[model samples]
Target: MRVVSLVPSLTEAVAVTLPGVLVGATEWCTHPAGLDVARIGGTKNPDVPAIVALRPDLVLANEEENRAPDLAALRAAGIEVLVTEVRELPQAIRELDRALRACGASARPRWLDEAETAWLRLPPLQGRLRAVVPIWRRPWMVLGRATFAGDLLARLGVDNVYADHAERYPRVPLDELRGTRPDLVVLPDEPYRFTPDDGPEAFEAPAVLVSGRHLTWYGPSLGEAAGVLATALGR
Candidate 1:
């Protein structure tokens, strides 16, 4: 099946599991390094006309990474769009299977099955660690409520201090984050690159710099994400 993926995670999964299926992808779909395909545009503002011109049989997207209007535009052009929602690991695993099947993967990929096993094999947390996860630093936005990243951390025994906030990704005052007195400050290298020098200095707690792809992406990386993230959170 000819597919155009707007989500990076799905792009990597499709590219790895069913090669030669992707005809187009968003510029932000950067995993499986050296991936070569027609770049539609960014996730939030994809080039609708360019995508329609590709005439892909299926267009894959994430409800959060893509804009509703753009998906609507693609559907209006008679293109089929399958939007996936992944709020947590279980949902992400299910959605990945559903998406790949829609792309004509006759059987589930080994990597997908391994990813599920990897997460399931993770040892339960002896004690949870409280943390403040900052996604963006300009206005200081953090992971709040039912976020995939936050859920991943929780599975690894790190609890988000702001998980009860009204907004999923809320912009809060920097001072307020510091005031939370979390056990650790978890930082990822995307949406905002939080370095040891930049992010950790703002808070008194120790900092854990992690791979955003492993922490956030829900595809092939999921197999190794638990180990990588758990190790980082341990340090």
Candidate 2:
């Protein structure tokens, strides 16, 4: 079965679930090495021509990741597309299950079971860490209320502090941070790679550089990340 995965996390998970099945993926879909597959470009701007050339049996995408124009184009070409949108951990597992079933691939229901077991083992979040999650660098975009990242943070027992704001992602002015006086400021990697030393001197606090995908991605891999982050948080 020829399959093209547009989302990076699915690119990795699909490869694991159905090894030697993926035919194409976006440039960012690099994991489970030696893929060396065809690149169909990024999420927002897809290489339509290259993807068309692949002539895939199934095109796997994510609603929040891929742009509508690309999806419309693929559908216009009569391609069978499966779009997954995951807001929470369970939804992600369900989406993966659905994708596996659609592809006629070998996907066991036990993946969800194992994932749940892993999640149940993590310690509940205890302290309210005043944290800031930066999604971008220039102008500095942060995860606000109603975003997946904010929900994930809440699940992990850490409060967003910005949860009261209505925007999903809001850019805060540097001067506004002065009053917040965060206890732990988290800089997520990708979208931007932030280092502990890069923690601005204007604020006196302990900051941590974390993996964005690990903290925010709601996918089959979330259970793995929960354990990792829980350990990191020493919970």
Candidate 3:
């Protein structure tokens, strides 16, 4: 079955699981380095015509990462689009299983099982640290309530200061985020590509750079997320 994936994490999941089944993917879907698939475009603004031209049997997408209008356009063109909603780790695993099955994967990949075991085996945190996780700068957007990143951090004993906020991704002033006085400022290198020279100096707390794929992506990377993120957090 031919598949075109718009979500980066799902793209990696399908590519690594079923190899040549992935015929097309977004430009942002940069995993399994040396992936030689047709580039459709970015998550927010995918090239509908280019994707339709691929003649894929299934199109993988996410409710959060992909734009609604693009998915609608794909469906209007008679493409079978599988939209996955993964708000947390458990949901991500379940949804990935469903997506793979829908795309005609014969069996569950070992990475999925490994990812589950990795998270489940993580020792309970001795103490929790209050944190403010900033995803972007300039305007300053942070991980708010009910975000996958927030839940992942919570599991790692890092509590997001704005986890109780109404919006999942809230845009707040830089001074307001500093006002929270978090113990640590966790930074991920995607969406905005926050780096040590760019992100850390603004905050009073020590900022630790983390792999965006581990912190955010929900594919094979999850198997190593616990260990990698723990080490990055200095646990």
Candidate 4:
């Protein structure tokens, strides 16, 4: 079955589970290193004509990672688009299983089981460390209510300071971030590439550099995300 995955995590899951099944993917899909596939474009602005030309049997996307218009266009072109919604960890696991099964997997992937088990094994939270997780700079937006990253961090015993915000991703003044005085600032390496030299200076709290793929991705990365993030959080 020819498939095109628009989400990086989805790309990794499908490629690792059913090698040679993906005919196209976004240029941003950088996991399962040495992946060689047709680059459609980025998640937000994928080239529709280029994707349609590949003629994939199924196009995999996420409700938040992919745009509605792009999915609509693919549907209008008569392509089957399976858009998954993953606001939290449970939803992510269920969607991953459903998406893979729809892609023709006879049973659940072992990595899926491993990923779930890893999280289940986490020791109870000793201290709920409050943190500010910035995803972007300049305008400065952060993880807010009902985000997968926030939920994942909660599992790791970290709470997002802005988790109660009305917006999923809220733009806050840099000064406000510092003024809120969170326990620490968690920085990820993607969506903005927050590095030690780049993101830490803006805040007064201690900074913890984390892998964006591990913090945000929900595929095979899930199996290791807990351990990786736990080490980063020093919990």
Candidate 5:
């Protein structure tokens, strides 16, 4: 079964699980290091014509990563599209299972099992830290309510300062974020590539740089996320 994936994490999941089944993927789907699939453009603005030309049996997309119009266009073109909504670790795992089965996977991949074990085996947090996690820098967008990243952090005993905000990814004034007086500021290396020298200086609280993939990507990297995030939070 030929598949074209628009979501980066889902792309990695499919590619790593079923090798050559992935015939196309978005330019942002950068995993498996040396993936040689046809590039269909970025997640938000995928080339619909190019994707349709691939003649894939299934097109995978995420509720957040992809634009609705693009998915609609694909469906209008008569292409079968599978849209996955993964708001948390558990949802991601379940969605991965569903997607793989839909794509004709005979058995669950070991990495999927390993990811589940990794998250489940995480030790209960001894203490909780209130944190403000910034995803973008220019306008200062932060992780807000119902976000996967926020849920992941919560599971690790880090509570998001704006977890109750109405917006999932809200753009807030820097002053407002600082006013929250969070105990820690966690920075990821994507969407804005926040570094130790870059992100830490702006906050009064100590900041720790973390792998964006581990923090956000819901695929094989999840197997290492618990340990990696724990080490970063510990430091």
Candidate 6:
């Protein structure tokens, strides 16, 4: 099947499971390094004309990552579109499985096995730390409930102090973080790079800079991420 993937996580998954089937993808839907697929703009604004020209048998999208109008237009064009939304890790695995199945793929990598093995090897947290995971800077956003990053943190046994908040990725005030008094502050490397001088001195605890993809990207990459998180959290 010729597929156009609009979601970054699903793009990574398809590139891993059904590589040749993916005919086009969004520019930012990068993973499985050096993917030479056609660029369809970002997650929200896809190149509708280019996508239509591809004449794909399927277009993969995500409810959270795509804009409604673009999807609506595709559907109105009588195109077959599959939309996947992942709130947690398990759902991500399920969606990836579904996407692979749609492509009639039966083979999967050994990463799932590695992930299971890593999960079993994690040690119990001596003292779980409260952490704020910042996905973006400037306006200052933090990961909250129902986000992939939050789920990853939960699996590592670290308490997400912002999980109680209703907003998924909310702009947080620096003062609010001070009031929370997190034991650890996790600054994600992408979207924005927080430096040691960026409010670290004001923090009450030690901070760690981490790869956002390892903490947020949910797909075949999770196996590698599991190992990284295990090492980071001493899980």
**lDDT leader:** 4
- Per-residue lDDT tens digits for candidate 3, residues 119-170, read 9999867898999999999889999998888888988999999999999999
What TM-score does prediction 1 earn? 0.98
What lDDT score goes with residue 94 in model 6?
71
Model 2 lDDT at residue 49: 80
Q: Would you list the C-alpha lDDT of every candidate in the order shown?
A: 0.93, 0.75, 0.92, 0.94, 0.93, 0.78
Q: TM-score of predicted model 2?
A: 0.90
User: Candidate 1, clashing residue pairs?
Assistant: none
Q: Can you give the TM-score per candidate against the true fold?
A: 0.98, 0.90, 0.98, 0.98, 0.98, 0.91
TM-score (C-alpha) between model 5 and the true structure: 0.98
Ten residues in sequence with the least summed lDDT for candidate 2: 196-205
> Residue 95 error for model 1, in Å?
0.2
Alpha carbon lDDT of residue 46, candidate 1? 92
List, residue by residue over 1-235, the lDDT tens digit for candidate 4. Answer: 9999999999999999999999999999997898989999999999999999999999999999899999999999999999999989999999999999988899999999999999999977777889999999999999999999999999888999999999999999999999989999999998999997999999999999999999999999999999999989998
How well does model 4 score by local distance difference test? Answer: 0.94
Between candidates 1 and 2, the TM-score winner: 1
**Stretches of model 6 off by over 4 angstroms after superposition:** 107-109, 195-202
lDDT score at residue 133, model 5, on the 0-100 scale: 98
User: Model 4 segments beyond 4 Å from truth?
Assistant: none
lDDT of 1 by residue, 48-159 (tens): 9999999999999999999999999999999999999999999999999999999999988999999999989998677889999999988899999999999999889899
* Weakest lDDT window of 10 consecutive positions for candidate 6: 107-116
lDDT of 2 by residue, 1-235 (tens): 8899898888877787777778999888767677778988897888988998999998999888898889899999989889998766667767878887776666655655687677766665566677776676568677787666676666677777687777877888866754687776777777677766564443566666678778766555676787777666555
Q: Candidate 6, residues 89-198: lDDT per residue as tens digits?
A: 77777777777777667855566556545655666667677898777666778888888788778878788899989888888987887788888888776667666776
In each prediction, how many residue pairs overlap at the backbone (N, C-alpha, C within less than 3 A)? 0, 0, 0, 0, 0, 2
Residue 65 error, candidate 2, Å: 1.4
Ranking by lDDT: 4, 1, 5, 3, 6, 2
